[model samples]
Target: METINARSWVERFIKTVVDQAGELTELDRRAGDGDYGTNLRSALRRVEANLAGVASDAPDAVFTAVSDGFLNTGGTSGPLFGMWFREFTRSPELTTAALAEAAAGGVAVVQRLGKAEVGHKTMVDAMVPAAEALTAAAGRDEPLAEAVRAAASAAHTGAASTESLLAKRGRASYVGENARGVVDPGALTVALFFDAAS
Candidate 1:
């Protein structure tokens, strides 16, 4: 019943990332340079700017703005996260299935861009599972709220499960077995997005 307009969705997303920035930075510190939080926050600001002339009712337009902002912002996350928003825009509407489809598209983009697949200790590992869970929930006739909640839970579980996976993508890939016990920052960040939407 809590259908958010584009502006509200954008604000919620910004707040989610900002609130979780420290956590994301900590995760990155384990294997990366600890810039995921900074990158995402900066990108969100750009997204806000891009939305200045756009209508909040147009979720697709908002999505496009997000993708463009991320792409222009520059960073590994730029392409990785950008693909997710771009994929969301490809959907017909901002329905539960559309969100799932966007998550799927994100995973696919990460695979193609990073040359990493499932079980590779990347965001795709978490996102792919979350997307499947959302899709399954939709198939079961769950309400949009319930479906998003399920997806957020799945994303969290998937991110936690990453602690057991060896590094095979991004900076973590260089860490090999050392990355096994740490959750991926990017994966955790994506989970936060699900939490925001839910």
Candidate 2:
């Protein structure tokens, strides 16, 4: 079995977002405030800074840093992401079963707090699919990489589906018809997170 490195996973997620911040912001600009990228980057910066002080490779410690950064950020997406990452900190081990549980926990908290369902065209869309994929993968005793890959695939598909959905929640909802062609940045971010885990 491959040991999932929490620090490495976080580093990859940070890099992926940093490289694609402009694209994410552009998506937000089309349907919502153009601050999604900026807020996400700021939170990532905090995560990076916090990571410097965490000498341990434990999943909980690294995820706590991730959670803290997002929680401190100012935005609806930030807080939701913060709570989601916080769920991951519940288990020190990053085993497949633990990932499934964390994903389910994260989805529950995000849904409860955001009040967004799968068809609501929010982060919950991608989050729900990713969690389901992780659960299925865990049930099959799949390898960590395979599980993450499945999650990423599901998340990406869910994010893509958002392009055709008329937003029912968040800033996009206010725009009505304009948001139809644009993908939800939050959903895309969820997809990126799962991809990083791979």
Candidate 3:
């Protein structure tokens, strides 16, 4: 199997997020502060601009660079995502199992910091499912790309499911039942990340 370098992964993620920025903003407007896309776009732009200075072959170093960029960006999502990427520094390899473990570690950090769980109508809704899918694929000894594809598919489904769930966390929770029927932008963003990896 061909190994995907960190640079390729980062590039794909940035491109996907930038291309879908407008849609993400619209999703946020329906249930959030309407600035999720703008915040993510700005953060990603910084990541892209600094990517050349990062070590392309070292996943940990690349993730560290990405974490710093996101952490410096001004937004709730930025810090949360930065923490998630920071955890990726512990990943030992780019294989399916390693990636799944890294993703689960990132989810744990998010849960600890955000205090959100599945069915909370937050990014955890998507992230948890994606990590689970990746784990299952890894257990089956699937290729890294296939495992990532499974994660992407699960993330999309999980993000979509949030539309029917009442918000239980974040600013959207303040809207109570009215938040139902509008997808969580954070969850959608997590899904997009896995999709780009695939």
Q: Score every model by TM-score.
A: 0.90, 0.98, 0.94
Model 2 residue runs over 4 Å out of place are none
Question: Scored by CA lDDT, what does every candidate get?
Answer: 0.77, 0.94, 0.85
What is candidate 3's lDDT per residue for 42-154, written digit by digit as tens? 88888877787765557787787788889988867789999988877777468888888888998999999999999999999999999999889989999988898899899
- Which prediction has more favorable lDDT, 1 or 2? 2
State the weakest 10-residue window (summed lDDT) of model 2: 1-10
- After superposing candidate 3 on the true structure, give the runs of residues whose Cα lies further than 4 Å from its correct spot: none
lDDT of 3 at 186: 89
Provide backbone clash counts, one per model: 0, 0, 0
Better of 1 and 3 by TM-score: 3
List of clashing residue pairs for candidate 2: none
What is the per-residue lDDT of model 2 for residues 1-198, given as tens digits with 9 covering 90 to 100?
776799999999999999999999999999998899999999999999999999988999999999999999988899999999999999888888999999999999998998999888899999999999999999999998899999999999999999999999999999999989999999999999988875
Arrange candidates, best TM-score first: 2, 3, 1
Q: C-alpha displacement of 30 in model 1, angstroms?
A: 1.7
On TM-score, the stronger of 2 and 3 is 2
Candidate numbers sorted by lDDT from highest down = 2, 3, 1
Error of 2 at 113 (Å): 0.5
Worst 10 residues of 1 by lDDT: 1-10
Q: What is the Cα-based lDDT of residue 57 in candidate 1?
A: 54
